[model samples]
Target: MPTEDHQAFVNELVQEHGQRLRSFLARRLHGAGADLPDLVQEVYLRLLRIPDVQTIRSPRAYLFTVAIHVLHQHRLNLASSPEAVDIAEALPMLQARSGDNPAEQVEAWDRLEGFYEVLGELPPKTYAVFVLHRQYGYSREEIASQLGLSYAMVKKHLAQALVHCRRRLDAME
Candidate 1:
């Protein structure tokens, strides 16, 4: 049972904030072959199920927050699947592009994967805060609130994580 007012509100939200939402997802999912329109549709679908959509004070920011969550869930699902193929399979055919070197690109990806593996060796809370802030683009304040951590603690953890990542990357280099 959908109310006309609610439908109208959603429509208004789509019209005003749709592009920004899509662009946000576009940047986060740059190499994942994620369709912006499809992601936007999924966001709207989730919005429809939420009973308190109208109560949100900043719908645009809320929409981006929801979209980020959706993207995170999508990545988790992909990572969880044993049969999932590597994203390199979806890269554009660039044989004709003079500046493109598939070998180098693949090497870089492997290095990044190794970097993430090193990141995983960190304590769970430290890794979680680092991933939420660095990978998922959550602010320190937002991550602290979500994880029930003090802001100073989050900063300290991030600083430590960054130093560790730097050392690891340097060694790799």
Candidate 2:
């Protein structure tokens, strides 16, 4: 059960920030075909469900923090489920049809595969930071707090990982 004050606080926060939140989600989820407004509403609902969350000083930051976690979980859930192979089959055709030479296309795919492989080889913590910051558009501060790491440490890990990825891809060419 939520307290009346907490409920009221949430209501006010939603009213103030709802549009901004929707826009944030829309940019992040561009072309995903998901309903950005619904996702923003879900984040608010989750915030309401969290015990004593109203005690936080900056509720807007807390909302974004929760929203990031919710988005990550949603993506993981979707990845775990088996899906149709239509997209997979069409990917090569799409790539080939794009205005590029055959060799350039192959090299591009190879570099991408190498990048994924290098990412997999990274330590879990480093890889999480890299993915959150690079793939998911999280800021260094947000990644540091979410992973319980220092900002400097996150920066170091990300820089080293990027260097390694670039080196690996260059070596392949």
Candidate 3:
């Protein structure tokens, strides 16, 4: 298909069936449905990567097939990783530990917020590797497979992220 025609076809599919697509993912994701947007985006990204959208005779069926694959991958990520506390969920626990003092609570919140801010400043791939390994407990091999990086490159990005974070944290003090 011509590029313009393929794009129009895909856009029409999204406009017509986006809600059903989201519902399908949300059902499979269980309570992890907060990631609905990301999963949806992943499905579209995979669709865009296909060299010949014309070969897909049934676009809606193909779209759902892609969503199922994405969901399976998402489950694999969650299952393979150890129990991991999302940082947003952890912030309240940190506040509780800092006690009832308003000033201490504020300071604790500020520090955690600042730490995440520093993380956000890293290069995108580096940040992803660090989060998948440290925050989600993914093995380097798994991260390399998922992110399409070499195992050595995953290690490199992770190390760079750590060093960058450490320097920023020390400077913050």
Highest TM-score: give the candidate number. 1
TM-score, cand. 1 vs. native: 0.49
Using TM-score as the measure, name the better of candidate 2 and candidate 3: 2
| Tens digits of per-residue lDDT for model 2, 31-143 | 65475666777787887787776467557656655665555455444433455111000000112232336566555544543455555456556656677777667889987
Give the TM-score of each candidate: 0.49, 0.48, 0.46
lDDT against the true structure, per candidate, is: 0.64, 0.61, 0.70
Candidate 2 regions with alpha-carbon error over 4 angstroms:
84-173
Off by over 4 Å in 3: 84-173
Candidate 3 displacement at residue 59 in angstroms = 0.7
How many times do residue backbones clash in model 2?
Answer: 0
What lDDT does model 1 reach?
A: 0.64
Among these predictions, the greatest lDDT belongs to: 3
The digit string of per-residue lDDT tens for model 1 on 1-173 reads 55765577678888998777777667656476556667778888887777765687656545655675576556544533555421111111112222346566556445644554566456556666777777667899987887677999989988988899889889888
lDDT winner, 2 or 3: 3
Error of 1 at 28 (Å): 0.9
Residue 156's lDDT within candidate 2 is 94
Query: Which 10 consecutive positions of candidate 2 have the poorest summed lDDT?
Result: 84-93
